[model samples]
Target: MTRELTPKGSATRQRIIEGAAAEIREHGVAATTLDDVRTRTGTSKSQLFHYFPGGREELLLAVARYEAGRVLSDQQPQLSRLTSWRAWEEWRDVLIQRYRRQAWDCPLDAVVSQLGRSTPGAQAVLTELLNRWQGEIAAGVRAMQEQGEIDPGLDAGQAAAALLAGIQGGVVIMLSTGRLTHLEAALDVAIQHLRESRDRHPADH
Candidate 1:
């Protein structure tokens, strides 16, 4: 069984994890070591081990989870309140800016790459993130359908899946080419398609 930590102990443990995440971000995961984390967090070997009994791999899993959460958190109120066309546009801008600020080097991608996709916990982290992301997009599509801003006959789930795939593919290209144009284009085109669908089926609205 896992040991329960006092409030102070919990804070310390969180500090260690945050510190380790920063270290990995700066040095890359393959280059970061437990000693580096200990020194950076001002924690001793025992404290580090106490929190991460499974050692580096366990700590890495924790970091992966953290980064995954960060990805969705960064999208914020815009992602959650995508009820109107204006809101969707705002969300699009937010997504573009968020990734642009990363300069094509996504933090979550770094963690997944270092941990390797085949790692036991890594895929779960990715799958959860993608599912939540696609869910939000799907929700936004359904909202527009209900509002009569999109075609009622459209498949919200499939539209969301295609949009999500386009986004990921565009991000991959951005990473490879160091250009945000594809990402921007993908979002604009996807949103435009939904808008055009409404136009195509005016009687359905």
Candidate 2:
């Protein structure tokens, strides 16, 4: 079983994770070393081991989880407040701008790729992130349904899943081709479909 960390220990571990993430971002995951992370975080070798006894692989997984959280957190208040059409548009724009700014250098992708996606640890981290993301989007769709802005008959979870898949596909394409068009189209078309659903059930409204 894993031992629970005290507040200070937890803070130190998070600091190390953040510092390591920064080092990986600046130096690339393959080039980064535990010593580099130690220097960046101002932690001793023993101290580092105390937090991550599994060593580099363990630290990398922790960093992967942190970066995954960032993927959603980056969208912020807009992502959480998707109750209005305007709010959804804002969220979409934020998501687009985020990827546009990051371009090909995605920290989450880098870490996960380095960790090997098929690895159980990496798969768990990604699976959790996607599930959380889909849940939030489904909640937003249900909000629209409650407001009579979406077709009540439509399956919100399925719609959200489709949108999430499109977003992932768009991101992959953008990463490979360095073009944001696909991502933009994905977001626009998904949102358009949701909006058009209202027209499909005019009598229900």
RMSD of each: 1.8, 0.9
Candidate 2 residues lying further than 4 Å off, grouped into runs, are: 203-205
Instruction: Please give the TM-score that candidate 2 achieves against the real structure.
Output: 0.98
How high is the lDDT of residue 23 in model 2?
Answer: 99
In order, candidate lDDTs are 0.89, 0.94
| Total backbone collisions, model 1 | 0
Q: Which candidate should be chosen as best, given lDDT against the real structure?
A: 2
Candidate 1 residue lDDT tens string, 45-78:
9999999998998888888888888888889889
Q: Which ranges of candidate 1 are over 4 A from the true structure? A: 1-6, 203-205
* Backbone collisions counted per model: 0, 0
* lDDT per residue (tens digit) for residues 16-88 in model 2: 9999999999999999999999999999999999999999999999999999999999988888889999999
Q: Name the lDDT of candidate 1.
A: 0.89
Cα-based TM-score, every candidate: 0.93, 0.98
